[model samples]
Target: MRNTVLDMTRLATMDAEHANRLLHQVRAAILAGRRPPVAPRPVIDASWQRMLRLGFDPDGRTSSELLQPDELEHRRRATVIGEVMRTLSGGLTEIADASLQIMVVTDPQGRVLWREGNAGVMRRANGICLEEGAAWTEDTTGTNAIGTALAARRPVQVHSAEHFVHTLHNWTCAAAPVHDPRDGRLLGIVDVSGPASSFHPATLALVNSVARLAEAELRERHRRTVERLRSVAAPILCRLTGRALAVDPHGWTAAVTGMAPVDRLPLPKTFGAGRVWLPSLGMCTVEPLPGGWLVSPEESGPPEAANRVVLDLSRPRRWTVAVSGAAGSWTQELSPRHAELLYVLAKYPQGRSAAELAADVFGDPTRTVTVRAEMSRVRRYLAGVLAHRPYRFSEEVRVEVLRPSHPSDLLPHSSAPAVVGERQMPGQDVSAERRRS
Candidate 1:
């Protein structure tokens, strides 16, 4: 007896309004991105019978075989990916079910970067279909869910006859390709699959939702990069221009109290964090500004010679304090350019490469030959001002320059250029200079 739940004649006479409502609901679910339940129908095909005779049961897989990592380093590989996915999915356990399966992340060239989902699901899915790390291009896998969606550059539902593989005729699958935001390049594909007779109209929506969630993870990573850049730029601005500046976490401008703003854009306090850069003062500011100490130049003399000022930013929004000691007093003796370089080093403190120091202090990274020439001048000036002092230039500054000892202190160091001083102060006076700045 032929068994077809979708009898054209019977379906033709069905209530038009009811069918329209069902289709409408499915579309809404797709746009809203909801996961739908699968329907159960009798599997009476010869393939099902053959599978039953051969003892194939997607639901009855043993723990060891399914969870086994194909590689010798299975535990190490599985632990990292499993923890990452679990965190990303927010304690999601549905995808860990025996019937569900893992879809490993792969490159366009079919290199696996990471795998998503549980081992049990991967094992069962592999027994009946493709397994983790399997090459799954449309040409090889034959136009099912994952491969087809990637080829089409859109989401898709491949039900029964849509699958090219004869063995896949008993399965229904939905898939969507995830893309990177920086270049809108394809990253990977996510798919949901199950027995053909258990197809759900909302499966397409589920696949799309999963893909979107993955994209959000990339957005967070970009935010972190921006934060690091702003952090590196802020103190340099304050030191060089003798201004108080800040960049908030959301990349917003806290203030440019002593520095001038450059390249103004429509800064919205409500939208993304505002980015403020003061070129003349050599200060860059970033949103929700952190409460900390702001180092500025004392107001009593020339901007170049002004004493060091430490403002307590712990309570009120902004206030200034006069810096004490010979090192703090020596600010007047240093040139504006030298003062800026020192501030950049103090703020950055992870001694910069010649190229990086040149870019931040001189605003040129490409002028390698010219930068080296200028470094000599900078080193000469530093020696004249802090000659015989504890401060010394270093070349090996790393990204995490000064590891914070406590919340208030920063271990300052520089590698911009070496100096030879004219006058040598006594060790006590040199020690005082070191403690003052």
Candidate 2:
């Protein structure tokens, strides 16, 4: 018989009791370091692996101090998510209440910013401290929808026994992350949670739909804001005779004069009005617009040199690259894949071809197409330091990599073939590991 993936949703819909029992068995077996009768979903399995690696106790109590009243109020007013709360609540509140669940909205850090729904459910939630200001990130609450979705940077559903912590096994949650449509940064999470007995596979789909709707609302609002800014910018750019452009706070182009209209420009880390240097635009003068900035580049020599590169992967959750030289300095956060690729490059200064990189990352040299596409994206920002022929950092630039304290903890979110192999390596550094790879 061909082995196929298990369908937890269908099973739970038909017979929740049987499904719960089976999941308990599977969770117990997996936690005890044994093969389960059936495996959990890939997302859940990955979360469990991370928890295990960190020695998370499945039976331990889970809770954290609530945010102070003043800080909680400030967060509520500070996040962009607050702008879409009404839309999210309108789309999800009724459904959650009808299902005897609660609608929850959390900031990217997984702190509850707002929650509402069934009256009885609200009281029960208080028992678990699932109210405003509670931190629900995986580090504090284990593998559940709000925390796991935040960790994975995507939507997730955690049913009975799928949770790494025993306390959460009695609850079911479906959460989808809301990201800023302008730049793709995580804004927050929208979740529906209730007692395990109330589990409905369809709740996941509902939450995801509402999250997408919230993004649409944000996108439409931004369009109108930019249009208004354009009115203010068009006159300003035409008045002065120079390479001047107006951009939204996020660096989205609104109006331009004397240059090609670029959709967006990457702004420097420390951007402000007055004389400042941008790597792309060179020396520029900036002035505050109502919702954006007006940038005028002084007709000068050239953009600054970016010779030194520092890839910092020392933290478990965050990774960034800082570049600096004769001109100025700036930093950009690297995605998980980018971090892995950069780590590999930093190990072997000799560089790796597309095929070799595919083999190093996927353990399959045939996946060169994917490797090349990713390198193209990396090159977009690092064109100065990256070279193409064989896909390597330029020799003229110095590349420094900051590694995690424990080699095994490197790229905690990465399970690429090369990353996993390196994490399991016995040695201290990658010199001997390079030969093994």
Q: What is the TM-score of each predicted model, taking all chains together?
A: 0.36, 0.86
Which regions in candidate 2 have their CA more than 4 angstroms from the true location? 1-7, 335-380, 389-391, 406-437
Error of 2 at 192 (Å): 0.9
lDDT value for model 1: 0.41
**Top of the candidates by lDDT:** 2
> Per model, how many backbone clashes are there?
18, 0
Q: How does residue 126 of candidate 1 score in lDDT?
A: 62
lDDT of each: 0.41, 0.82
The TM-score obtained by model 1 is 0.36
Model 1, span 96-141: residue lDDT tens = 2333544444444322334556565555566653554455555455
